[model samples]
Target: MDDFREHLMKAISLRKRIRDTRTSTGIGWDIIEQDYVLTWVLFGISRLEKLQETLIFKGGTALKKCYFGNYRFSQDLDFSVRGDYPCGDDLLELMIKACDIATQSAEDVAFTCKRYPEKSPHPEEQEAFDIRARLPWHKDFNTSVKVEVTTHEIILLEPEKRVILHEYGEHLNASIFVYKVEEIIAEKIRAILQFAKKLHERGWGRSRVRDYYDLWRILQEYGQQIDTASLPLLVKKKCESKNVMLHSVEDLFQDRLMEYLNEWDHWLTPIVPDVPERDVVIKELKQQLYKIFESDNEGVRVNRTNVGAA
Candidate 1:
């Protein structure tokens, strides 16, 4: 346990360095977290493929990479199976079978599975599932990683559309089973607008507005990449109609400049004190990394500078 603690501390230090560099360059933490999540999600997908279970990538990761240039941060891993896929008894059994296999192969993994409640009984039923896991220790045995997995029934508004949404308003010209980019973007845009309205109703302050602003910037960046000529008129119609009009990019740039004017004062605010529990978890993970460094394996390094960086 002592060894583990030491390794974990080293890893945390490295992570901190990387985080600091990213922040200095104005990169969001979400992007780093998403990359870590993707590694685990890909592992789970490989397991499903080995079993020959019918699954296809869906949601933000797919949309972000194939369409947008990997700019967005996705918190959940999403997959979809055919509506008619055969299964015995309840949906819960199928979910358990998948989670059980994923957990068995995953290190420091945890999972929860649940069914999406039916909106109406007549036409069809849909189910959803989620899995969470810690990332494998690095080759050098420094740092800790974590991710969440989710699965849901496929539902596309425009059943026949083939385009998938990407970051910056671009779309990926690919098919993932029954899902398409157009539908995904439409749904996401609608959700963003809804959330923005909710924030206003609750009288949320600048931070909440900034969150939506970030999302909008990502969408606009991708959206500009889209080729409207090839899409079905309906898809283009929706894309053209939807707008998040929070503020223009120029306005945001100016706001950021103003924020820097009071950056030190903001950091000193009492509301922003560091939490010890979060630090402890980070420390343990870094110790695990340090152990990897000490071992005379193919890949290990004990660099204090690296530890502090992470």
Candidate 2:
């Protein structure tokens, strides 16, 4: 058993090295950039907690764990607060105060706060006022750090409503709790469909289509038990807004899903190879994620285990 365990560990390590190589060779640096961004967001969150404003992890990072394996890289940090809890101006003041406590200047951070503006059919229908902040830092003689902070309102839901939306109603989990696997898959499906339409409209590269296809495959393989009743509604809404064709969601489960799964298995699966300096990158990320969650001096805590082993 001990020998088997050692071999397993060795194999895992090798696989990780190969995966890392693949990521580095591709646009994986975007993921690393996102990690840096999240680090700054966590710093701001820590500051916010000092001022008595609680922030919860939401959106893609949460989905990275809840849907894609935690190993995937996410590009942004999103948080939501109760609509009636406080005004946007007050939240900015609190955030600014938190920065002051940390001896960080407001100009050094990307900070934006605003209410969700009304939506209409004008050309600017998508435009809304949002509070945004930028925190800048000098990393080295040539490198600098800038972190963006933005605040927006989501419909306030009762705890039960939030739970239902997070657990079953929505594809991505709501901010009210730890993200779940099912919600992530559902959200990704929605995102894929949306992106596909955008691609069709712009006549752009097939990246979005390919990613949507890949995500669909991953979800189908690992997300068979997901509740899918709301999927059609989600597809219809996103497609209607984007002016894209509404592909049958059932086709996602039946076919094309396996093709992406096979691609991931063949391309992403790690191979046993000696690679130095690999552990350093993984260790740094783990530490950063830990620091962000731990710095919330307030009682608010993220259910870290829910993200799973990755």
Candidate 3:
């Protein structure tokens, strides 16, 4: 109980600190709120890591907070397990426990969490939780944080440990599981492929601009570190697991990467300031994707682009 109180006090203190630091120009209050929520989420994940060794953090938030520094503010926490989570344990209950532990560390905000059961039979598409957090001091700001669990086999090749610092302050450190940089890059590529597949079947959905941006950012910062030889197989395995078939990995890249280009600036400009000029980013990404796909098919060629239309 004392620990919980300490967390609550620290949370409130951090909340005030974040509120006070919201003077940065050109960034909206909503974005600042998003940052605040992200801070709380990181603190929450830190607590979970202490209590649950099974859940290893992955995805955009992990990349942003743990490895990649170039990503825009991400709204959710994603995790994958080494194997099936024990049967009959409610995910929401588990998150609540994690949240409680988090509140103990910083109890400034109120957390409301709801579990959405897995809608698909595929093990990879596991259940998710929607967490809505409201700071008691800031009535106008209620942030939504999604927590998605990936049941697919997470190959944590060259896993790295990162101590996540609450941006409002640094004394609070939360350690998290982060996959190798190359694996994360492969995952981003896989995300674009998956997004394309979903779009083809449904005709409309969320955008994959973030994946493109993250891919570009990683390639720019850690391009040499990415395991070039292993990427295609990794991406292929991911597509197979999701039952998402692709006629050609190169074609998949050409179609999706091109499509995402049209909306890139619209979605990316606000969050990522140094967003490379369109032609530069697209050209660079195409070259990288082609290299990843070349080992499998030599016929891979860059699709002609009408930069003006895009």
Candidate 4:
């Protein structure tokens, strides 16, 4: 009984701290609050039976949840699943189980899992759904924690087990399989190129400039440790799986790098306290990203660090 009371008190305290965080961090309360629930959802998925064996956590959320705590407020939980994916109904059942686990673990938080139809040209290549998390702190606000599972990726590197960072207690200490820094970097590169091609061909695209934010930032964090030689091959597999192609490393980004860099600050202003300067991010990425293809590139530092590991 006393424990429940303590949990309730802590939950209330968290609400106040969130407001303080918003003021200090200059991020929206909505994003900070939703990121809290996203952590729980990730923990819930980690606890799902044998699901972790098949699902490889990747994308921006993986960077935030598994690698770095100070990353952007990424709401989507993206995964690459091996073999046959569960059907819509079955996947929702699994998501419900995950939500139940989150509800059980977190105080004053409840999640309802649901799948909605997404209109995509190649819908069979990917599956995405969301679990709406109801927040006790905010009476009028609730947010969807998006879950995306894709069959379009081929896992080239062995998945690494990384510790999950939670805002609360030691009981939340759990780990899950995630993409190596190398693969995530490669895929983000492919994603950027893919978006760039669309913009050039159709004169309209999503302009997923966040991939650059992720690319440069992650490269700054994990650049030296990556296996530079294997990255190009990894990137090739990613692009091919998505039917996108990049013929040269020097020309990988083209004018698109600078084009998207222009939108970086505006797009990231809401999600992070201080967006990085455009010139700094691109300058660094251009130098290191090329090394991903030039296996023979000299002076390429190869210190494999364990900062991303448990």
Candidate 5:
């Protein structure tokens, strides 16, 4: 750890010297700081990949950081293991050990990484657990990246492994298991619908604008090519297993989606420099969601036909 600290200090000093020589590009220091913190997190995530072979990276963070290139500056690292690793306490202990390895690996490059065991609010809901990564340099500003692990659902498609090269840092690469784009889109839609349902019933305090933003980005990239046939049914099953109601697509868009749109703040202003206008996003999203629901229903028909033929 001491050796890691020494390397980190030198790197910081070098970064300061470089910044002093260069003219400002008008990018906010807050964003720069966030990028720096992300590099450390990436280093740790890379180490995590090495530690657990079964861990398949998923969710918004994976979409933004590893693939998609949408750059949303997400704060959580979500993973899905191949099997029910939650079967025993020992697997979690092993995962924590892997996190410690990640901390050491990050420390080697001068970033201090610390892990905290986060208690689940409702473990029975999804058998989910959290491990947060605390970065040293960004301690003053949003220093922690929460890593959530779960083994609740099965992924139908085989995950593809890709080597992610850091956009901000030099000489940084991490190979990770990334879910297919279709899989990601399906899950994102499911999340938005589910969250919208919650907002409709519970009346507003917990609006998740990020999910909406992601869904819009996915639509822009994939358009009508995405397969969401099984997504609604999967989400329905998930909600049922958790004893939550599954709302209709029309209800989600008519009421809750507009509510989520209203909550977009500084935190989720699209970290990418060239972002679509808010009104533009809202318009496109409405059109896209309608199309997506139609496509998803069509997929259900296709699947039913294939099963009947079989």
Candidate 6:
């Protein structure tokens, strides 16, 4: 237990790493909580390496850790499993294996992980679990990291074993399979479209603004590297997997999208150092989307203008 706590204390920035992070980023104690969540996420990732072949690390968390460090502070650890998503006994077995790995790795502490029984209020395709840690602050040892494992979509490209970029003390190290930027970009576009269709049905808060934020970053950083010509096919497969039609560019660009954009400020205010202007992001993002995903048919462009007019 002494060694485990020792490594954790050093990994937590409060004593050392926090000073350097705050001096440059001007972050507050929220970062301390984020770093705390990160330590457990990384430690748990070490246990999850056994499923690397079937489970692919993904979502904004993967983007932040594997590819873009200091990008965003995401809370959940998201993954995509290949087929026949694990459940009941299968999931319990996976968590039990993870426990063994976690326990064996610890020097003296026998801290373990669990797959709890309660259901989270997430989408149907996704299932959530909590990683309970024996932190000194919690009286019941209830501190946790939220994890989502799903079979929501197909893997459009080969997953890569990328090194994790983290500042947790003592190199609390691990590497896992990650999705390609191309797949991520296509999915973000699909998500923006998918969420727009439902944003008004259930509630105003159904939209996820992170997709737009992530796409903006990808456009600025990885635009040249992506195979734009093949993006339409990738996007088609993604939307199809979710039972969503690949509507024409104009059909998907509607007032609902504008409504979705309006929530960007509320979504990103807590996570980023400087939230980009909502209009600027929407304007530039629309231009890039038209350039990349625009249909070759000239009538579609004509329809786009009239669609907005209507």
**In candidate 2, what are the lDDT values of residues 1-310, reduced to their tens digit?**
9977775665455345435644654535333433433443344444444322344444445444334433444444454443333334665566445434333422233444344354553352222223333323223222122222223322222211222111111133222233234334344555555544444467432233223333434443544554444334443443454444334332222233323233432333232122213223223433332333333223223344422221
Q: Write the per-residue lDDT of candidate 1 for residues 259-299, one digit (tens) a residue.
A: 43233323222211231232332334334334323332332
Runs off by more than 4 Å, candidate 2: 1-40, 46-59, 65-69, 78-82, 85-187, 205-214, 217-221, 237-310
> What order do you get sorting by lDDT, best first?
4, 6, 3, 5, 1, 2
For lDDT, candidate 3 versus 4, the one ahead is 4
Model 4 root-mean-square deviation: 5.9
Of the pair 2 and 6, which is ahead by TM-score?
6
Query: Each prediction's TM-score against the native?
Result: 0.40, 0.40, 0.77, 0.86, 0.70, 0.79
- For candidate 4, lDDT tens digit of each residue in 114-167? 775676544565767767877775563278768888776688888998888765
lDDT of 6 by residue, 1-310 (tens): 9987786664453345546665666555455455555544555555564565567878888888888786866767778777554665677577656645654553322345566456555566466666654534335544456677776568989888887776645465677788887888778777766676676576554666888788777776768877777777787788777766556665455676766667777788777777878777766766666677566532223234532222
Cα error of candidate 2 at position 162, Å: 13
Clashing pairs in 3: 4-104, 7-104, 7-105, 7-106, 7-107, 8-107, 11-106
Worst 10 residues of 4 by lDDT: 301-310
By TM-score, rank the candidates, best first: 4, 6, 3, 5, 2, 1
Best candidate, lDDT: 4
> Which of the two candidates, 4 or 6, achieves a greater TM-score against the reference?
4
Off by over 4 Å in 6: 1-14, 39-43, 47-49, 83-86, 96-125, 134-143, 200-205, 250-253, 297-310
**Shift in Å, residue 11, candidate 5:** 1.7
Instruction: Give the top-scoring candidate (TM-score).
Output: 4
What is the lDDT of every predicted structure here? 0.39, 0.37, 0.63, 0.74, 0.56, 0.65
